[model samples]
Target: MAIIKLSVTERRRLSAFFTCLVLAFAAWIITVLSNPKPYVVKEVLEFRNTPQKRAFRPLQSDTVNVTINGTGWDMLFSKMNSAYKAITIDLHTLESKSYVVLSSQKDQINSKRESDQQIIAFNPDTLYFDFSNRKEKRVPVHLISAVRYQRQFFQSGPVTLNPAYVIINGPASVIDKITSWNTDTLKLDSIDESVVTRINMQPVKEGNLSLYPKNIQASIPVDEFTEKVLEIPVRVLNGRNIGEVKIFPQKVKVTFTTSLSRYAEVDEDFFEATADLDLWKKNGYKTLPVVFSKIPDYCHIIKIEPRNIDFIVKE
Candidate 1:
């Protein structure tokens, strides 16, 4: 069959319809681009400074999961960004019955120029906090853990610590968690009788925790306790001609104290005493000064301690 040609009026009507459709499409595109729909982004948010008691250990983690809203495209492109750092969370603001709701800030938004308040939604409006109030107590800091000792020494016994107890104040919820205080090892070894010394105290791991005194005091006992009287003989070193020399009452006295076990080890044989004889040779003097030779390490001069003695040399 032969096709029938369209009338001018019919053609005009079809053209008008096509033009209207194009215009509507263009308007729709502009509107969609100008006013984009919002998007939601999930991020880990942090809250800090939740009031911990001074005697309590500071909690290491304070982060919560949260969803943020922003530009649809921005959220689609990058939903998760940097790990959220905690904005300060004041624990003091919270009461036993309720929690404080922090208002979202402008900078809290996940996307640029988008308000976090507008796009963010929290699963729970406020996090529930549980606390048990505790009465104040003075608990002693015990050095229960044995510290590592230095090589060549053994700890004689349990070390005595000064001001062992600490006054702690916290809520009943937290005070129950505490146990006792500990310390680093005190080294005792190869120690002589004079080995009386103290060690420093160890620091607690928790920052919020408090002790009576910031420092720990410790004392280590040594095993050096013996007493002995040693008879020491004195001699003159490097002497020459002697016309005439005489020492009145010669020998000096010395004493030492150590443990009974090691008493035999302490004796006059441990030290040397001597006097200079060069003056006799140089002066060719008939009379010279008497001098003592060596002194023992394990002993000290007693009542008859002589600093100077007379000596005679043959000329």
Candidate 2:
């Protein structure tokens, strides 16, 4: 409940004291961080100069704990840099040796990094790999896409990929299970026209597997759609007595939507409607349901008039 106010001179002295204390703290930090120190950071491992005669699969994880000797500034910035995430290891020695000593290649690895930072050591000081029979094969390329079309717009035809197949080289056991290689997802919104672009293929997850031509060209056909109506004759399927089975409405109207470019090319011949007579013989159904046995590609059926037809089976 007591108010004590200091004199202006006393307040100035207090402010100066605090300011000096802050400067001393900053000076200590600068002195300590300026000196070189060893710090540990985990980095991904990538292999280069892979042996051609043999296929390899690492027995351990693809990451290593690397001890880097550098100033505090270098260590701080290296962690923040995305490029520092992975360190490439030379596999040239694998051609003759089964393992690689990380320390022996420290100089080679440090050459690619900043001059201020040096790789001193790494955990799992030695890397071991398992060898397998090398094999090469050609597999089809599968495109992955997520596209949304505008109103009355659709894909008119199948998407075409340049170099429809890619060559893969890897361990025999791994390549045998892979039938196709998939491209990275091609995402688009409100697609109204054909798409022609180059997309990169998905990176091989296994370190040993390799793909030629990391990217490919893709072409997609898109067109506006319009409604078309056709009178399709219904054929009786699985009829024990074909001539004896009589169905009302032999022909039904088929309404469907097709691309504008192919509107005139489509007709009743492109569609096959059928009424199964087995419903009355086996299931004792009163009416037969009209089913479409075939339809043109990319054609979407909207409605079929008289879905179920009245039938009379003569004994």
Candidate 3:
């Protein structure tokens, strides 16, 4: 391959143009090197939950460290000044019975005064909050679901709950306007007895609502119960035994309906209505004494069709 060479005049013009280009580039570099861009050194404000062992308070004062950066003229232009902004700490996200370190730095801070400049490195990357005020509040709890009852014989009573309320407190902005708390949905498919369960409390947010104690203690007592058909065994008590006495229907039959709640306390043999078997035997087979059985204090024999019957003795 043959190399093409520039002519004498062409070479001279090209050389001059090259020299000018190099000089322009060198001038640009010098300008940039001599005057650097301006920057600011503001405090890296980090907040910590003070009373380190105890829970964090809503209001507290935190310390901050500020520094500077960039050219002297840039600093003069910046007019370094302290920055202040409303920082919000949400307590709702914190775990129950837990502590956390939250912080807020100047997200977008520019020096308002001259002679202020940013530093490449910030002073004290973290800040400590001297939290002092401890606050707590009683929050109301509301029920949301209905528990279903079991079979026809079973009955569902009013739902009962222990410590139906909770208390929460935090920053004013986070604690103000908290409405109410609710438990998870309760479903009773086919329960005959009382039911108990531990449910998580859901918080209602009206306005920034914050919770101090994250986990709420819950207790539900389920009553194990079932309906029972207790047969009241009628027995003859405190009556003269007549020899060779004849009685019709040796045992009086009684039927009644009651709650399974009182089933355990019910004693069919205790229910009794006096029947004069001796009187019947002497009266030539007259009306016999009919007795009913005793039942639990809370239960009642709603219906007793036949209170008395004729007594006959077999000879």
Best by TM-score: 2
Each candidate's lDDT (Cα)? 0.50, 0.90, 0.48
Cα TM-score per model: 0.34, 0.91, 0.29
Per-residue alpha-carbon lDDT of candidate 3 for residues 131-246, written as tens digits (9 for 90 to 100): 33345578776655555655443332344555666776554444455566676665557665555665566643322234434334433333434444444434554344544544
lDDT (Cα, tens digit) per residue for candidate 1, span 18-63: 9999999988866664455555434443444445442233233334
Off by over 4 Å in 2: 1-5, 77-84, 241-243
User: For candidate 1, which ten residues in a row score worst on lDDT?
Assistant: 53-62
Q: What is the lDDT of residue 310 in candidate 3?
A: 54
| Clash counts for the predictions, in order | 35, 0, 38
Which 10-residue window of candidate 2 scores lowest in summed lDDT? Answer: 238-247
Tell how far residue 115 is off in model 1, in angstroms.
Answer: 15
Q: Please provide, for model 2 over 1-315, each residue's C-alpha lDDT reduced to its tens digit, 9 standing for 90 to 100.
A: 999899999999999999999999999989888889888888899888998888999999999989888888777877787664788888988888888888888888898887776788899899999999999999999999999999999998888999899999999999999999999999989999999999899999988889998999999999999998899999998877455777899999988999999988898889999998777778988888999989877799999998999877676
Quote the lDDT for 215 in model 1: 52
How accurate locally is residue 308 in candidate 3, as Cα lDDT from 0 to 100?
56
The list of candidate 1 runs beyond 4 A from truth reads 1-62, 66-87, 95-97, 104-125, 144-146, 173-215, 219-315
